[model samples]
Target: MTKGRSTTWQERIDIVQYCLAHQHDYHKTADHFQVSYQQVYQWVKKFEDGGQDALKDGRGRKKAPEELTEADRQKLEMKKMEY
Candidate 1:
């Protein structure tokens, strides 16, 4: 969404979902999502405090992680597990 980062909406949603499902364990969520713990925590905070709109990457605001989408990340992990 930003110049260097390309975080997707689904990724944001998935991150928040995973964190919520895991009882808001930032470190574990971060590890499972392959992102920084702080990122997971911030996403949870944003999701909880602002809902879906908050996860949106607003222009002129701080950028989120720029890597694989949720599906891609999950697929990659599945592939890794297969190997």
Candidate 2:
């Protein structure tokens, strides 16, 4: 949740929950969460700043092609059948 980098929604939630539950020993909680202490710290910060919504998935740029249009896909199928 730092520097505008995207993180998985589950990661955010797990990190926050781990820290909250083990606040007495954050180092152990960070290890249990499989993230650096810094990440746990960040998630806790985000939770404090914006509540549960802060733990939602971060949006990122995707590299895949868009879904084909219905018409275009039907035309392609028709062409295949004609062959």
Candidate 3:
């Protein structure tokens, strides 16, 4: 496995597509992309489960109200009331 490196969203999508195209060969994909095998595997899995949108880097981003579950919305409301 190669050392993982930062990849852009488009790169991740490309990697996932490549892996899928090659019959989910994670090792080959990782080697070709110069990323860790685990990264290729995980990206492919996420894409399979949720499509391209799932490949986004979502860290530190707040969810929109509509994107939250009912329970989560209620929790947010309670926290707002506390403040």
lDDT of 2 by residue, 47-77 (tens): 8899988876646944333566777778778
What is the C-alpha local distance difference test score of each model?
Answer: 0.79, 0.69, 0.91
List the pairs of residues colliding in candidate 2.
none
Worst 10-residue stretch by lDDT in candidate 3? 1-10
Model 3 agreement with the true structure over 1-83: per-residue lDDT tens digits:
48768999999999998998999888888889899998888898899899999999999999998899999999999999999
Q: How many Å off is the CA of 43 in candidate 3? A: 0.5
Candidate 1 lDDT over residue span 1-83, tens digit each: 11223569889899899889988888787776677777777889999998999998777864344656888778777999999
Q: Per-prediction TM-score, please?
A: 0.62, 0.52, 0.75
Candidate 2 — worst ten consecutive residues by lDDT sum?
1-10
- As for candidate 1, its clashing pairs are none
Would you list the rank order by lDDT, best first? 3, 1, 2
Name the regions of candidate 3 deviating beyond 4 angstroms. 65-83
Model 1 lDDT, residue 39, Cα: 78
After the best TM-score superposition of candidate 1, give how far the Cα of residue 14 lies from its true spot, in angstroms: 0.5
